[model samples]
Target: MFVQFFYMLRERGVPVTPTSFLRLQKALSLGVIGSIDDFYTAARSILVKSERYFDTYDQVFAHYFRGATILEMEDVELTDIAKALLEEWLKHPQEMAEALGLDEEQLSRYTPEELIRYFLDRLKEQKEAHHGGNRWIGTGGTSPVGHSGDHPGGMRVGGTSRNKSAVKVAMERRYRDYSQEGPLTEIQMSEALKRLRRMIPHGPRDVVNVDKTIYETMRNGGEISIVFDRRLSDRLKVILMIDNGGWSMDPYIGIVQTLFNYARSQFKDLKIYYFHNTLYSSIWLDPQRHLRPEAIEEFTRRDPETRLIIVGDAAMAPYELTGANAAIYVGQKESRTSEERLKFLARTFRHAVWLNPQPESSWGYTWTIGAIWKIFPMFELTLDGLEKAVQHLMKRH
Candidate 1:
């Protein structure tokens, strides 16, 4: 099994050397590799020397084991009875306003708080199978609840989403086949990333040498002696989320990784997290995206001073951004939509901006891009865009 695993990694272009393989095997023999997870960590540490190969190593490992698919989709069945009931329930537009003791005119003028309260109140009253009717749990209604419907400020239930209306999207994503196929140079990319730098002064360090300087000045008599002071640099604490693994983003993977590597070198206090298509529940730090699972709230606790930069095209299917459906990886259930997650993140991070790799003209054509732009002032991936994004973050900060 181990020998075949070595051959598989080599075939996958993992640069696995005999020395590295022997080291891994020796570690396993010494009872160091206790579990599957431990074995993976050990093997990768030994065999994979470059960070760029981590994703490929993970894919090869999973392929050999027949494990979870990267962007796997599964079909969830709805019963014929349930489907019929849903269709039957879709007949009337629910009088959602009346259910909460307000009419259409009054509800339209309702304050944000009032609307929330009204929705909550109506939710408490709903008990039976409802459809297009104004008062029941059903479809095609004016009610703030239920889907495939129309209502001002309606809270849509399961169905086609308000793709045009969503204000945000989670920023992290995936990389399908981790191959840096381009001839891009890190030096050039890092130089471009320099546009995003925040050159504020780092906090003061070490005591001043006033006494020594004075003594030296006195000894020199005519001229004042100078003490060389260390220069101050802006110490930035940044949380960077990179969206990867989409067909639309295939051309920009190298661009994204280059930016990532550059950011790591530039921001000493940078914290990186990853996600796919959309952020439903969490973000990850590892290429496998399982070893370091970070909850949504984890981002909120980051220092408010930390500038949160999200890099992605922000182009994806509408369902990935809105509704209750985990459309990409089916059978996964998330209480909040991708839109809600982005809203939370924006509100939580005081300084945040999105850097989009796609051209500005293409943004209007993609529903998801337009949706995200509403919440974040997105900039193009060029130097000017990065400058604009940095300037915005600075101004907001």
Candidate 2:
């Protein structure tokens, strides 16, 4: 089994070595792994040298084992009663919502910590179903701990999510195959941005000018005179606008997240915002699309020289962008259409580029992709694509 697992990783382009495999075997023999989870963690640590190969490793591991249980049956504390409640709510969601007069405004919000505590407490204490109330472990009410209801900050126990407001999900699989492909790791993305960092330098003369000092010393007859200059602090203000609200972007979320996480730490002045389909009236700070969104004007008002990197497939109906079909944010309409908004963004940010996860070959097949490509320089979201995009941004910088 172990030998098969080793060969599977290599076959899948993971670059697994014999030394690493032997180390994994040694660890297993020494009883370093007690549970399946422990073995997985230990094997990953021993076998995978780079995070770039982690996704391949995970796929190989899953294939070799047929399937690995994330949580053992005995380890889970959920009861059959909870399962029954989920089913009941799913069957009669609308009926329960109407009976309770359950509206989002009536719901009370709870902190994540409070929600967890309350959810666990109610799970243990409550023995019967209670409907349409603020404080119970039942459905269709203002309670911060149940499904088929409204709570701005709550724990979703079970059932289909109405609004994406739940702070934490207890157990569910609403979306399919969300596992990351891990195309771009943090290190790779950060290295690409490092080129941009080299271009922009501002504020504080902290770094010593070594060549200038030596030249000055020679001019002053061997008397040492040091010169100081501004250190290259990352003064490159960047606005990362990502489209994560649709299913098309689900697969690329891993690469997007890697870029976002690295860009957050890489740039001194960086602001991240989320949008759906295309640029509209407003953009959200949270990926869940729950939080109050900021006006598009707020972002455009920033430094015009700020590098704008838009990450999306740009695959949408032409009507969605051309204003033949209205695309509003949070029920509020904008004076400008989506296409107009895209034009305005291009004009506002002097330096902007679009990073499309969709392959460059298939880009021409999508009408919206070509439409947006004309407005902004579009590049693939791979490592090579990122390097090219960075180079384009630097030219404008």
Residue 141 of model 1 has an lDDT of: 39
TM-score, cand. 2 vs. native: 0.52
Off by over 4 Å in 2: 1-182, 198-206, 210-224, 328-330
| Worst lDDT 10-window in candidate 2 | 145-154
Per-residue lDDT tens digits for candidate 1, residues 88-126, read 533421454544566667766865435543453344245
285-372 in candidate 2: lDDT tens per residue? 7665567688887766688888999999999878888873478444666677788888889999978999998779889888999999
TM-score winner:
2
**Worst ten in a row by lDDT for model 1:** 165-174
What TM-score do all the candidates reach, one by one?
0.47, 0.52
